[model samples]
Target: MPVHRQPGPTAGATSQLWPSGGRHLWPSGESSEVQSHARGHLVYAANGVLAVHTERGTSIVPANRVAWTPAGFTHQHRAHGDTDMRIVFLAPSLARLVPDRPVVFLASGLVREVLLALTGPRSYDPAVPDYSRPARSRLLRVLVEELSEAPEQPLHLPEPQDDRLRAIARLLHETPADSSTLAELGKAVGAGSRTLSRLFHDELGMTFYEWRTQLRVHHALVLLAEGHDTTRTATACGWANPSSFIAAFTDIIGTTPGRYRSGRVVQDQIVVAQDQEQGSDRP
Candidate 1:
């Protein structure tokens, strides 16, 4: 079963207006209606996590990451946990600086600060000096430069094109906790394990386990947004123990479940430090 829920904002959601961007505080599970923008935009989840669903795929935007959607693509935003969501739209000229397709980028400390400032209270406060067009442009340019310098994260879960793969994907989406092996799942989808594995690599560019991890992470984020405890979420996502789940989640998300659930600023700096030590961002 696809995780279907009514689209649009739920009760208790509040937004702050800004010309170039805005800030939205959403309760857990709140989602925006499927919509398209005239200009490409970047979305960041400062406090919680966000899933940006587009026709191409879904991009997971945790505190350590930012998601960009190119102009004219239909997309929807869903909040995981109590989310402080920020949005910044780019002009046609600036939008050209980024990829035409939707992508997720690692959020450096500078990028996070710039996003907050662009959509912060200063934009709407009469007493505060607002970000002039040129100033905002500079900030946006900084964002583009920072993001462009690094490789895009593998946070996108691409939608498979094959019918057999789609069938198998649906099974996992409906019940992420299902511990079925590839051969077992292959039997239901009418494809041999070897054939399905080849299709996974050829179509989705990942192994079966890799794809399932992404799905489980997506589901886990939603569950956490609904106030599910880490242990419950871990078990629900097919992890036998919370320790294993935390290790996996932290490796991908750059933060532990405890900190993420508490809505604290993630230890993204730690990830940055590790990247710096490695001497390459592409690894």
Candidate 2:
């Protein structure tokens, strides 16, 4: 069965599934229906960008990051551009090595290579030339160990539980370009600025301004992935100028929007080629 319907005529898509996991090619603005699985899985976007949304919140997966979804959590995925998404499901024993909740980890070079290898054809094939179960297990162990050594990224945007906070969040999410101050937003939500500020810190572990900035950056990522120009994305995401937007985006994403757009496709293609070469050379 098809994992997802083709995006549209303008954008091509394909899905291939094996025993351990699958790959999905999604165009910008494509989204999966809400779903869950029995086993925990890791998702990586070799190209473009992905947003993994669950009850917990949304996690952004870029070329250099991996997003984990624990088993049994309700979630959906949306692609930000022409995305090459790879998924790897872990056995119960291996799943225990990761966190119980959904999280994002910065993928080191080693982790990226392992992820590509595990999702490549060699691991999917059950022939003598394919990776033995023990070899695959060792690779998984190395992946988990490397992940553990790196600190969790702030790429996850925590969902707010409080009613007032939720109301405020809804407004901001609906219009990321809105430049309303916390005091003004509190009035619209029927709460005092200080009270809303407290709610934001207590429930989301960030101040209202901080949370809003993160939200804007998230929107900016989606816009950029969809091929929007940097100045346009900056304006649409509430940044008054391109320089400020570039600074904030670089600070959080480690790259300017221009570079991210131009570089990710080439970088991902190179990685995929390396994986294919390595798999073909394997005994």
Candidate 3:
């Protein structure tokens, strides 16, 4: 009375699934980059972290996070340092049920099993729709419910809205590493230092220094997602040194820049270079 699972897709079959869809297992030190030309699929970071970014913003998806990307978002994704990853591409039809937002869900044991099954050959059965399977069905329900709930800890850094605060915000966004004091920023933005400090307090609800730190950290994340290493990313973002960058990144992102770079390196190893070379030779 025991259940039997069929062997998964053969190596040749998996190769065909590449460049479009498949379940891929990435051990430490494997990485890939991809540009989505068609509909953006649903992706789950089964383990480790996956960094995703677009013009709107950047987000780091920790283990168990579910990201729903709409079609043609122009984003890059990679695994976090020294961690294994299992990524499966959901079909376009199934992707519509979720919102076009990045969400990190608490993965239950049942959800974990369902995610594992998605990577197997059963997912490719033409006659068997992804949602038709019992596990898949349950997972869909959970995902919908979680999306409806607000995040326990919202992930966005606060932005200032007052006129003087807006000026400072613009400067920070444009040049995150510019080490100008409040007085200098105020003068450049046409406000007095005390006036700007009052505006920062009223609008952003944080000190000027605190708000600038948030901006710098967010900017650094964007650079890292683009495949820049810690040393370069830190220097470009205006940190005095790599250690300063690491401290800020760790404080805000809960991981060091080096670790973030390591994940991308792994993903790049697995997916980007060879694929691009192959495409170049095709013609």
Candidate 4:
């Protein structure tokens, strides 16, 4: 079920000016299986959001953020909207700059442009003059440099190492709208409320409330990316009302949910937002 758009060019195809793993476009709701690459790479969304899943956890990459997966790590990708996904591979030396664990980083305007230029279909437009290999190398380096200096976003919902934590995570993940209190959820999992709360903090480094808020906001992003209106998304994500959801979303995602739905995170304020997240579980 994996779709490889713009199939890798044959070997020796024009001395690829930069390290690119070809480009692919995925429609909303499509996903790839767990796969690993020989080299590390950056996965970027030109116009939508990507849910990058790995062993550690899932890192959501909206238009303003990029996801990094180190070499040989098993991973999968899911598209939230009509996503124009682009990739840039990295050699071992360059990959070392990025952590072995998956992470999401803010993508500035310059970084976005550099990514598009290197992977865009018309990158070699003769009218603009060919981008020589040397120029391409410099641009790629700049892309790496930008990522290295950018702050890491807490868009990751780390998976717990405990089976008890897994039970709680699975329940909420299966039904994000489920508003069961920690105590109520505990009943279903055979763990007491106090035990669950302690596990949540010890395993995930956040309180149960914080984790659920993160989970709800994550769903809101995916729904918004899918072009759903605020009211509907708010209802589906367990918000009492759109107003409350808007407040929480703006506080966490740094922009109103409506604006995100309109898809307007252009170069103007690409780096204006703080940490953001969006994704769901699938085996």
Candidate 5:
């Protein structure tokens, strides 16, 4: 079935059974309207990047990461590049094990395999005759266990509530490459660096520079997924040099940007091959 970017409270990001939770294949630039779920769910990007925006912050889910959206968090999603977006619904029993807030987790090799097998060709094979219900339940248990073992990555950019901090955020967000320091940015907002520091520390729990680096890395991910090269991506996201950008990206995203893009290209190729095979099999 063709997936259209949905609009409404749940929008198109609906919850489904464990075996095949709502999976969507979104084109580049597609976005869902603000929505909330009654059940917590896990979202995995089989081949692209997904950004989840909510009242508290924005969580970025790259191909290498899986995101947990706790139930009742009002959020919307957007896809950058052609995205193969997959989701898994979690009942309260399973959801209680993870963080209550939106979190991005590093998808280890085991986690990835379990996710694909649960939702891929193996799940629907006719040879299975009657797909073993107990086995499917076991796979789900393994998936949750593996995910719980992986560390929650710092892929979230916390949103500021203070009007002054928000003003500064807007400017930088509009131009992430802007090199202005906290003190310099304070000048525009008519506040001192110390005051802004207090706001960040009290509310967001991070220093100004740390917050900006996280923000820049978030932007860089979108750019890289959209096909930007290293040098250009570094420049575009406000890094003075590629080395510095690469270092920051690796520290936050767990991989070099080039490797990230290459991995995505490989995933795209696999999707194309699968599509061609599927078409040939059609009568």
Candidate 6:
């Protein structure tokens, strides 16, 4: 079932004074789908997962993580089903001071304050307050610095290579929870289990099982960001049980899947949500 909600008011009516902007808090179990207009914005995930998908690609924004979306890009925002999220949106003028591409930034104390201020109801005041100007300027500077200093070790999994491996990868990508064994996958791809294992390790830098587990984790992130509970996400991703899924998630992500999904983890929400509806019907 798709959970829908109304778009919150644009950030401080002062948004009109600038270009366009908004701030909203998506409680755990809440979601909203939006299509961008002439406005672009930078979104900061304060306490939960924020997932953004565009023609460029899909990105999972976790707590204390910020994402930049260029003007006119179509996208959607939602909280992980069991997790709540807080987000602040900024106009293009403010976003340009950040990065040109989508990036996750470490939230400094000042940055967090600025985000909170933007979401605050008082931000709507149009009066040019001397005190507010300096705060705004400092916020912009912080965004630029953080963008330039983004970490190199991003939490993203690369796609696999090799035509045969790619085919198997696609299958796994589509159905992360598919409990097919190496022999089964190899048979589907017209290769032996050993050959498939060797190919996965060579091209993806992981064993077949490892790569599949990574993919499953990635896909689980998507469902979580879409507001699906851990139980549903685990089942959707093919984990035999929620406990097993949580164990694997913690081992690989350094945190529980629920925390990662809700942006409580102290890292980027590296788990990516897959294209849903396409594979949910799969046996």
Candidate number of the best lDDT: 1
Model 2, 1-283: lDDT tens digits are 1122233322356676766777788877787879999999999998889999999999988787899999999999889988888988888888898899999987877888999988776744444256778897899899888887766887899999988888888998999999999999988889999898888888888888888888998998888888899999999999999999999988777667888878663365356557866999999
C-alpha TM-scores of all predictions: 0.87, 0.86, 0.51, 0.84, 0.83, 0.57
In terms of TM-score, the best-performing candidate is: 1
How do the residues 181-213 of candidate 6 rate in per-residue lDDT, one tens digit apiece? 999988998999988888877765678777677
**TM accuracy, model 6:** 0.57
TM-score order of candidates, top first: 1, 2, 4, 5, 6, 3
In order, the Cα lDDT scores of the candidates are: 0.84, 0.83, 0.56, 0.77, 0.79, 0.60
Cα RMSDs of all predictions? 5.9, 6.6, 13.5, 8.1, 8.7, 11.5
TM for candidate 2 is 0.86
Stronger candidate by lDDT (1 vs 4): 1
TM-score, structure 5 vs. true: 0.83
Cα lDDT over the full model 4: 0.77
- Model 4 ranges with Cα > 4 A deviation: 1-19, 122-130, 271-283
Per residue, candidate 3 scores C-alpha lDDT tens digits across 19-55 of: 3345544433344555664655545555455555544
Of candidates 6 and 4, the better by TM-score: 4
Worst 10 contiguous positions by lDDT, candidate 3: 7-16
| lDDT string, candidate 4, 1-283, tens digits | 1223333222212211333555656777777767998999898888778888888888888887889998888998888887777888987877887788788887877888898887765453334554667887798889888899988876777877778778888888888889989999888888899988888888888899888888888888898898889999999989999999999987776578877777776533453532121122322
- In model 3, state the lDDT of residue 124: 50
lDDT of 5 by residue, 93-202 (tens): 77887889888887766677777776654444444443367886787888888777778888888899999999999998899999998899999999999999999999
Candidate 4: which pairs clash?
A: none
